[model samples]
Target: MIDNGDDSLIFAPENGKTAEKVQEEYWKVLIVDDEPDVHSTTKLVLEDFSFEDKGLKFISAYSAKEAMEILNNQKDIAVILLDVVMESNSAGLQLAKIIRNEMGNRFSRIILRTGQPGEAPEKKVIAEYDINDYKNKAELTSQQLYTSMFSALRSYRDLKIINKNSEGLKQIINSTANLFQRQNVEQLAQGVLTQVVSILGLENSYYVSTSGFTAAQTSDSDFRIIAATGRFTKCIGTKVEDCTPIPADIVPYLQEAISKEKSGFIDTHYVGYFPTMKDKIHLLFIEDCSKDLGPEIENLLTIFNHNAGIAFDNVILNKEIHDTQIDIIYHLGEVVENRSKETAYHVKRVSEYTYTLAREMGFSEEESQLFKMASPMHDIGKIGIADSILLKPERLDHDELNIMRTHTEIGYNMLKSSSRPLLQTSAVIARDHHEYWDGSGYPRGLKGEDIHPAARIVCLADVYDALGSKRVYKEAWKEEDVLTFVRENRGKMFDPKVVDALFTAYERISRIKERFKDPE
Candidate 1:
């Protein structure tokens, strides 16, 4: 793919003179004239002239109609040397019009050449058609023929480069559209890969991941195939480490490709390396369509490989920044739990239960994650309470309980002003988690549907964990007793809708407790 700002077609400098050998086979040129000598002489004079850095192969046509048939069929032909009086006076001129206007071939350059000066006037003919040059056969000596081809070839090359760049730019713009649609790592990766394959017209791609080392150091040793397209699924889970039976020279070459984050093309195969783990690089091998590995295809492979590397890197950097934010929210909730030793794992258990319940309720992924992370911070205001009140072994008296009730206001105050989603959700949960479903609880005594659904969901998770576990002030209730309390409180203290979902997911909740069970 071409870079956006600079529309330059870069042919790699490393291949040097040998690069010409790769491109020499693809360029096509057509000649249309009645005289056989014109064909023999022209091919002899400029037979070695290579345009667009590729040597041309000539295809001859005796009549104007024959030239049109050849031009319509040969899509990659870059230039045409057309004789004006072939079969008719304006045959070549009419053919140029069809090539430009009818076929819509904006890239192939057309040059008009005539043996008879009287057949068509140069100025009128040149001004009328989309032809690049008008030349007299007698006047076009060996040197002049070379000059005509050189001029036509340069124009054809520039137009093709511009067309390719436009296509690549459109792909890049479309690739970023899915940024707002998905939030998790796997979904995001698929979105990026879908854009990449569509943009490049690739048949398939694969993803690999690894851990334990820095990206550059573990480039060869760490990669393990994690996900793959259907075409390459059989190779999923394969490790890239161990050069062993593989040739030593090929192994080191691949390893170096990973370390520099470079892409390489060998024959019909292409290798794209992406940093998957801090220490690992993933190699995606795409099967070639043409099957014959040529130089032009090799350059195209380089373009895709380079683009995939940048795209993959951007996704990883974004994932890291996002995870860092969730980490801050998680530990902040942990600080609230550290207040009372009996509550050390309270926030963790509540978060797990909340996520499981939201999943059971068929909530959107964004909603479920937001609830899980935000629910744990429900009692964050407890950080402001006195140790004597927070850790008391006896139940609070009336006046002391009134003071304890202020924690809701304190929790809401701590999070209410933030614009971030996690913080905003935290404020909502803090304020309404203590409110009752039947309009009985405080601080605003929000009733029924007045409270946010996020707050209602957290209320169930928080209450369930609170009743089942032993706190500093009470003994752990038996499982049956806890279930009875939740069932009895359904519409009065908890949202009936949430209570129903909780009952449906009881076994999953039991499993969650067992998974994150406190060591005490």
Candidate 2:
């Protein structure tokens, strides 16, 4: 250890590695004294001084104007040794004002070194200017200078750490705010990866892997690259070991973190483990972080991991609730179908057909899933119709038929009062699914675009399923017969665009029919 007086010490590397192989980071010090001897003497005395595994890198400026230029270019200068009597008697004072006010650099510790103490007295300069310390060149000995440098460097280091932590906290807040807007697990996972990287300042060369099971049960089959940035973008959705050009040892490190349920660091790479509430595991891998993995950064990672896991858990819980609601809707629709002497598969087949047609019509995956969930409820109004009219063995008379048509209005009234989106959509399908493209065929006869697009798509899907399935009043029609009816009714009974989408997805629709065949 090299002593800098007053018991302060700087320890050397224990491994005794060559200087060239072990690159040393340094604390930057700017010496802004007009006297050439002061600059040279200060560098000579502090040449061997080191602190916190770093040495001092002295930058020289012969005048205040030159110092300002250097300060403008370099951002990480830790301490400034400024001389009061520069080109002008008050040039150092003026530079201090510019640095604090104009440059907004409040972290770098400034020590005013002056030969003429009377020009700028120590008491007056300390109170008026933002300088941290004042020293007389005549009395400033080698040991005193080392002591002052040590104090200033320590203050600068602490200030920098506080600033970095503040920025990291801001990043975490912003990331979680953005994450709250995501509606699904995949989106939340991606947002968590992005925010973690932002907090750690690792924008480049990172990979995120996830296991859809508990750590104890996690295997290669359960692990997938959920979110990847930079060079690993192509690895998403693939197994970790299957990704090419990956480090051979990364998988083992990831496994260790998962099985142990903890974060791990190996050299410059860090693996963060976040166990979600669903008993699943998410691992974030980053290579070549912009900063060292110090105790402060490690603490920040721990906090981030905890919060991210909770956010992911909330998203998963919401998704499970949403899926359960959809299942309940399907079962309710099945009840209505069974009451009408229709097979339970009629509702399932209608849902599948509507999903296919919605996708073919360029609807987003989420919207298509909504259509699939809402379409099954289309005939729920039929449950309110009189049994004599709904389960009739022969064609209905005009009055009975009119009463039967009111099932659409009955179903709409039943669901329209609810505030849920799925039910609101079901209300629309119930109210307008029977309305025709050309001002005909409904209780209200809402024509053209006046009908909701969701109802329009489900209308064709329901009719297709109904005509192809056996009913109490009629036998199931042939595939060609149903197709001919759909073609004939285009623009007259159904939306022309919806009919076109149906024809486009004819093969997939056939496959759906074969898959969910009615019980014989």
Candidate 3:
């Protein structure tokens, strides 16, 4: 009963009985023998047999060459019944070795049957090849044939189960290593969801959603959906109950999984609970899995959840440290501004302006944040100037102005020694922010592209804020006067590209000024 690559089912007729309808999935049996009578007789005997609610499907091949072709094309052939004497006396034995050693197929059960046992001795053949059983055709009665087949099928089934478990474990191990490479919580959660579907071999059959919240928050409303895939893509950033058209029963199970701090399964669906350090809890939901959740899959999920918990904790801790560093940068910049009789909000305005210009210049979100953090330190060099020159109410002479110009180099020297990334960026901004676009400004006299773009952006932001805000030696200028000066100095005092970005983001620039205005 070989499949001819057509969408039709073929079954051998039993004696005086109509063949039963075949199950959707059946155990495949391949018969490799030179005799036509043996193939017909074997199929006739097993046509009515069923095991584990699955019927038998037989495939026939007359020669060993044809048998190898069938084996190459089909993947799930469970048992192969090979005859000892075929085209040659040793053909069956040779094919058995090829299947196990060369093809690397250890899951299929092979049984050797022969009419002439003297041609190939039983004990020698069994020891030499990887066959599962040896039987003499004369003594193989109907009951003996049934017994032999039942035992072989049982062994084949168990081997498949073991193989599936080994593959699942391998996937989980690889996924854990990949998940650890992500640096933030949102990225880690997305990776975990992708790996869980991959481990089950149901990547396209299931939809995954993950929600996270602080552990102290008990209400379901606090659990925001941080990541969602497939049908739940639009559910991201929404609370669980607010996800419209989601099954009502699934919402309660998600809440239960979080409240109880455990995983829950309903038929093919599952919810995994992971609690991290610092009172953070993550919940993963998988829906519409095409297959039943076996004990093996459940066990794999348990191991995956445990490892993911540690990775999630590391991401949260790293985020906290990052926020603390940014705060330190803001305060250090404010201290320098305060010494020059400038309000703290002046530094805040510059940071926002730099961030806006960076975005307009096509910088990524991460790079824009770096610009915002480093821009505040552009005037840190002013700290080194003495009060006699820095605080003078009148214009400075040549010697005193030259001393004021040395602050750029002084700020660079103060911060250049630090190994931290944020401080290193601040050092560059401090040194080059005073450089002119046309090789006229002091320090390095870096012209055009020689200066870093971050420094170029901060240069405009600093001048704009200083012109608008009142200082110790001058009154605040009108908004029109500042814009006119910026436009007039486009390619001489500042980079033309930076000036263009400033105009493009002028609305946001105005909003930042109003939001952080100094106290009256």
Candidate 4:
């Protein structure tokens, strides 16, 4: 496919000498004529040919089979001079179709030629097959062939630039669309590295910072690495200055990018400067000494960084909103806990438990965050209950118990009016968390799979956290006893799948419990 990813018009690196190979690269031309005389004559005519300062390098193919082999191995062949009657009358035309359709070689320009004009397809058929030019062997003088080669190489160069621009734009759009999918700054940083390396036509790149998404013209400590990939994975949380002896020293490039406030290549490494709305530059540094950078690649990188700068602003704003939302949920959960004289960590432990279980059950990381954020509001309806009912030190009378159960419905009513996803989720959990797997639960008495999966997960999480903590009517149960009861009640009081997820992640659950324990 001619490596049209804005990589050089020449060959890619082989044997780890990419820089050297690119420095001495030529415009590769393949001669697919059966006659040895045609090969010798073509090479002789173009032996001194240089288009845009790149001389022609000839590859000979005596048959279509050999041509296909050369095309498959050589990704950067710029021009194919094909004979229409090499293997068959339509062999050259068929090869052109395969190159364009099956092999996806859009960047290479195909020129068809034949000694016998009557045996060749018409000009219309040749154009249909995407052959750039048709030439009769007798009429193609050296001057005429030179003119054709000049036009073909120019077209090839334009196509490579256009392909690079389109691919870069696509990557920018994809990266911006994925901003909401990132769970943290570290993930966002990693995504930037992956996308940039792809757009720049390189194999691998790594490193991004959380604390110092700052402009490169600052202190070296400002660049504390948060996300690291490729060979730099071990550098996470380390400063760029501290990343010495790793082969590429990026501190200088970082400074250069921010000073220019533009994306550019320095000593073959690509350094991008993305300034946010806050008047700070969030630098992206990548090491690729192999790629041949031209004005087309530089322009593409500039266009991408413009979009990436905006993405940086959006990601930061989104992160702030996410943190604020979680804080509000925690505080709200604490209010309900305080009213019932329970430890604030009750809600904390429950949220983490739901998150852990959701992940262990194969829910995505984003879905698991929703579980963590909304589970704390499971008891939000208790805010409407009388203190006498909520904080009762003794078993409630049947009428009082029935009133206590109404807290679920009250909580649902409080949050169900809001259109937000988190609140809507909280409403579902508040109403249905008491519902059981065996159709023997409260409020609407919804059973089994009829319960919302979020609520079902919350139901099990609530029971587990509550059982292990001291309350007005009960002392904290032993951890072993808690596990036994949970397992025994599976498919009865709790969802069996959720219970199983807990067992599968017992050590993690235990750690969450210990981290948020009530003060002795």
Q: Pick by TM-score: which candidate is best?
A: 4
Model 3 is weakest, by summed lDDT over 10 consecutive residues, at 209-218
C-alpha RMSD by candidate, in order: 10.2, 6.3, 6.0, 8.0
User: What is the Cα-based TM-score of model 2?
Assistant: 0.79
Report the poorest 10 consecutive residues by lDDT, candidate 2: 208-217
- Is 1 or 3 the stronger prediction by TM-score? 3
lDDT agreement with native, every candidate: 0.70, 0.80, 0.81, 0.78
lDDT of 2 by residue, 1-520 (tens): 2335754333233333213212368889999987766765676667778888788788889888999999999988999999888888899999999999999999999999888999999989999999999988766777778889999998998898888788767767777778877887667767766776665552222333322211211453466777777767777777777777467777786777877888757566667787776677777777665445577667777877777778778887898998899889888998898788887698889899898999999999989988889888898899899888888999999999989989999999999999988889999898889988987868787899998889899889889888988889899999899999999999999999999999988899989999999878
**Over all chains combined, what TM-score does candidate 4 have?**
0.81
Give candidate 1's whole-model lDDT.
0.70
Steric clash pairs (candidate 4): none
After the best TM-score superposition of candidate 1, give how far the Cα of residue 252 lies from its true spot, in angstroms. 4.8
TM-score for candidate 1 = 0.66
lDDT of 1 by residue, 1-520 (tens): 1112343222122222112223535467788987766665556555567764678777889998998889888887888888888778888888888888999888888888887878788888877788888877655555556777888888876786666556555545455545334554445445544444454452112222211111122243565444445444443445434322223344454566666777655454344566553544655544342344344434554565455555556666777887897788778888877766556677888988888888888898788988998887888887888888878888888887877888888999999999989889999898889999998888899999998888888888998888888787787899899899999999999999899889999998998888878777
For each predicted model, how many residue pairs clash, with residues at least 3 apart or on different chains?
4, 0, 1, 0
What is the C-alpha lDDT profile of model 4 across 356-460, one tens digit per residue? Answer: 999999999888888789998999999989988889999999999999999899999999999999899989999999999988999988888899988899998
After superposing candidate 3, which stretches have Cα over 4 Å from the reference? 1-21, 34-36, 47-55, 62-73, 83-104, 112-159, 202-221, 356-365, 391-395, 447-450, 464-470, 474-520
